[model samples]
Target: MVYHVLNGDALVSGFKATGLSGEIIVARECLIEGDLKGETLPEFLENRARFVEDEFNEARVHYYNNVVPEFEKLLNAEPGSEFNLWFGYDLFCRANMWFVLSLLSHLEGDKEVNVVYPSFRDKHDIWLEFGRATSEQLQEAFDNRINFAGRDFRLAEDLWTAYKQTDLGRLHDLSIFHSPCFPYLPEVCQAHIDRFPYKGKKGRPERVIEDILKKNGRDFKTVFREFSAREGIYGFGDDQVRKIYDKVMKERNP
Candidate 1:
């Protein structure tokens, strides 16, 4: 059997439109992209779900329930089975992709793993972005998927551990050993590091938002929409953007 694993439910509809016959698992958890720490995947997910429940309450119950069962299939892959990963170029998608790669390295089976990412031309193209692509474009990406090499898996394993620890330095050091395996790793890692509050001057991305709000006097929603369209690398959703805005406002006004 073949499986097309996507980052989230956003792309599931588009993927289904392709009429592909296989299991489509939408990874609901953002794993490394969020503040989750655990020695094992289950522990990590449990912590993340709990973290979400602290804020969202029961709204995430259905999602939390699906995380484990959907993940188990990848954890225990059978021989002759293929797992195709479809993720984007941003920190959110790349971090999740690394998690899957890290897990696959430990699986004791002859499973085939492939990855489909935004091509060079599609890097900034809205059409090829996750949940934005048409069925035909998704099929094109699936048709031209790349096989994960040994180095790619090793890089992912190491990066996954570093990311979980929030060790940006380790990621920076790893960038020295550049390889085609993760051409987008350094940039994404850098984006993740920059998410932290800067010591001097305004924090990078939040600073951008602050400038827009201060200068243009736009509402938070407009600032978020414009900022996302401009930067596009961090892939911050509305909630994340709002969180940053709150932090920036607190620091500035207080």
Candidate 2:
């Protein structure tokens, strides 16, 4: 039994097209950029569920009842079963990977877990790359999955635990420790830290958006499109971007 887990639903089809046999699970929730104060699974889920519903105005009952249970199945995989994680190198995927790796770290399970990342590309959005990949390419990627050693696990635990904390400084400090577990981690962690508002004023990304709008006189939609094109590495979707735009508008009008 090989369980292939991916970052989101975007690449599920590509994995399935590989004709791999076993269950496929999507992380469903975004742990990369949100409030993570809960100490337990239930508390964490509830916290994220409420945040998503309030921020995105979407319910999480289906996620809690359905998608979460699927993820939990990885915790109980058979002795010989392999748990393959397919993720990208962004903070978004890194956060979820950290959570999953952390969860597996505590469990005394016999299942073999491997990390399969987008090794083919050094700077492209791996999720989008997977979405556009052919079936043969997906299978090749699966065949080339990398197995983690002791140092990787130690680094993973460090990163995962640090990511769940309220102190972004811990993550910023971790940038100095270069490890093979996450080659892009140092830079990505810095990007995450940069996301916080400057002295509780405008966020760096939001300020950049406002500056673009001011100089070009473009509408919000155009500004957002331009931002995505230039700054997609921040892993922010239009909805999150829109909130910042709204904040800027309120600040300007208020």
Candidate 3:
């Protein structure tokens, strides 16, 4: 049986409209933005559930109900199954995709894994393409999925470890060995590193938000559009940028 593991729910409708034959699994947790304080699978999931509850005010029960099962499937699927990974070329998608790979790495089997990219017309609009893909384009991508080799899974496993640990030095070292498995590993690494508070408790996103507000005058639409256009690397939607913008403004005014 074939399984489609999507990065988030936004792409689910588009995927289904393509008439693809597979069980669709949505990654509901924002793994990149939370503290992963567990090593074992069960432990890791519980930790994430707690993080989601405290960070987003979403109940832990919701996490267990919505997020845990899909991940468990990814972790405990039978050997020799086929999986098509549907993720974008952004840090948000990379984090989810890498975590999925890390789980698959623990399973020993002839698991056939493939990555399906968006049919993007412009290089700069990659992050936007997946969310806006047509059924025909989605089908085209699925028809031309890139199969992952054994080494690719190994690399993904290593990167996931370093990513959760936030080991900048190790990530820089690993970034040198580029692979098709990770389309933009080095670039994503740089973007990830840049998110940390580089100056006065303001990360790149926070700082950029500050700059946007100053130039565009407190217009939410203007800021969101500028941020999305300027920083496709993060692949943040309105909700994320809104959160960051609020934090920046709060701290600035306070």
TM, every model: 0.89, 0.87, 0.94
Report the number of the highest-TM-score candidate.
3
Ranking by TM-score: 3, 1, 2
Model 2 agreement with the true structure over 1-254: per-residue lDDT tens digits: 88888878889877777888878877776886667888787798788888877777878886677567866876776666777888777667788888888777665756577887666654655433354777777777777787766677777878777778846878777768766657667777877777777677755787788888788665888888777666665666677788788788787879
Error of 3 at 35 (Å): 1.4
Candidate 3: residue 199 Cα off by (Å) = 6.7
Considering lDDT, which of the candidate structures 1 and 2 is the better prediction for this target?
1
Global lDDT of each candidate: 0.75, 0.74, 0.83
Clash count list over all predictions: 0, 0, 0
Candidate 3 C-alpha lDDT tens digits along 84-199: 99888888888888898887777787889999877454676777748678888888878878889888888888888899888878887888787877777888888888888864
Off by over 4 Å in 1: 59-63, 120-123, 126-128
Cα RMSD to native, each candidate?
2.3, 2.4, 1.7
lDDT of 2 at 10: 88
Clashing pairs in 1: none
Q: Is candidate 2 or candidate 3 better by lDDT?
A: 3
Model 1, position 154: C-alpha lDDT score: 82
Off by over 4 Å in 2: 122-129, 199-201
How many clashes show up in model 2? 0
Local error of candidate 1 at 193, Å? Answer: 1.4
Badly placed stretches (over 4 Å) of model 3 are 199-201
